[model samples]
Target: MTFNLETERLILRDLRMSDLEGMFELDSDPEVHKYLGNKPVKTKEESQKIIEAVIDQYEKYGIGRWALINKKTGEFMGWSGLKLNTKMNGITNFYDVGYRLIKRFWGQGYATESGKKAVDYGFKVLKLPELYGITEMEHQASHHALLKIGLKYIEDFYFEEEKIKLRWYKIENK
Candidate 1:
């Protein structure tokens, strides 16, 4: 499936192999992976593998994270979109809204902007009943972004797979 979602200053679209360089830059930063278990990929090949996985997800689940681009500069800032999270933290088959931009893009309100768009797409476009956002407890920026985008803090729980405590946030269509 092809997707093209545009916001005021950003564009969300399907991931492509050509985005490898930007994906490498975004995933290689240790700072960017601090909340992601500090597992910064060691090689561009690893980043390529991640891209492959996301592509597979797109084919398998019909929805996955999208490539986030700056409309003004046309740069691959990072990725932000929805994923069909089949199982995580005891939840099953949930639609998850998430974002991750390069450190340079951090603190620029991109997360909130993309997140709100993702949530709207889930509810309005996909007609999902609800959407979820998960973040590490200390990732205050993500926490604030989720809330800023209208997800309510639901609870705190241990993510066994990631081996970390996470804050769960959700918003339902009403």
Candidate 2:
């Protein structure tokens, strides 16, 4: 499950065990999870399991979120890519484009940079008919990033279990 996609200043690659520390750092920050149910992972083991699940996703689905590394420093910044979502937000099966970075890496356009590449890979490489994105209603940054990645606003849906309103966006391959 090894693959790599390079942006101008970052490298998007499969999540591996070597990324446990960086993944922990990125996921443990409360600020980074503010819009994500405010649940920052509490242990490195949790991060390890998360990475392992992503690796399994690669084996099962052939694609998943990839680690985002700083090309110049080779530091793991975070993860950005596509994930196969099943029965999410009332959708049976779909590919969702997403990204996340360490708080320090925020505001640096890394998400958008890698996100655009993910969208390109989805359309051109995977030959997906369309791509989808979902963000908390108030996650302005995520909303903007998805739009910038070329997805158009589709609609907003209420996630009953989470009791949250989520905005959905989509882009079709033409």
Candidate 3:
């Protein structure tokens, strides 16, 4: 399969080693990570490791989170894609849609747009029966984004490692 998927305003591709700085800016924003770990990444080095791990996941899994770049300016806006994370509960434990955008990119409709494309990729193209998504129970924005992308609220659950009340949503191919 190709390493990238393109949308009208975004290019969703696998992260490269050179994307560390952009990744740092995206992952290290406190507000962006608020519903995530409730902490910024702390350093550029941590972003580098994350990029490397994402690359590794692509190599092994064939599908992984993708870096979202603004096609017009070639700027890294954020990332949105699919992953098979077993960590989230009350779901099938496979094929989840996820996104993390820089603070500056918030409220631009990018997350919902990319999420719609990712869900299409997962269900229409990837031929999965359904795709799951998780968000912190308090993350109204993420919950809104997921709903905008056609996912229905499934249930509330907990992930031990994240220690956050989570809600799961699913988009069915049917």
- 10: Cα error in model 3, Å: 1.1
Q: In model 2, where do residues sit more than 4 Å from their true spots?
A: none
Best-fitting candidate, scored by lDDT:
1
User: What is the alpha-carbon lDDT for the whole of candidate 3?
Assistant: 0.85
* Candidate 3 local lDDT, 1-174, one digit each (tens): 356778888998887877888899988888888889677888999898888788878787778888899989999888899997765474445899999998888888898999999988887777999888889999998999999999999898877877888898988898
Instruction: Find the 10 residues in a row with the least total lDDT in model 1.
Output: 82-91
In model 2, residue pairs whose N, Cα or C atoms come closer than 3 Å (at least 3 residues apart or on different chains), thus clashing, are none
Q: 2 or 3, which is superior by TM-score? A: 2
lDDT for each residue of candidate 1 in 82-161, tens digit (9 for 90 to 100): 99988987889999999999999999999999999999898898899999999999999999999999999999999888
Give the range of the ten consecutive residues with the poorest summed lDDT in model 2. Answer: 84-93
Candidate 1 lDDT score at position 83: 92
- Once model 2 is optimally superposed onto the true structure by TM-score, how far is the C-alpha of residue 109 displaced, in angstroms? 0.9
Better of 2 and 3 by lDDT: 2
Give TM per candidate: 0.97, 0.97, 0.93
Clashing pairs in 3: none
Q: What is the Å distance of residue 107 in model 3 from its true position?
A: 0.6
Model 1 quality (TM-score): 0.97
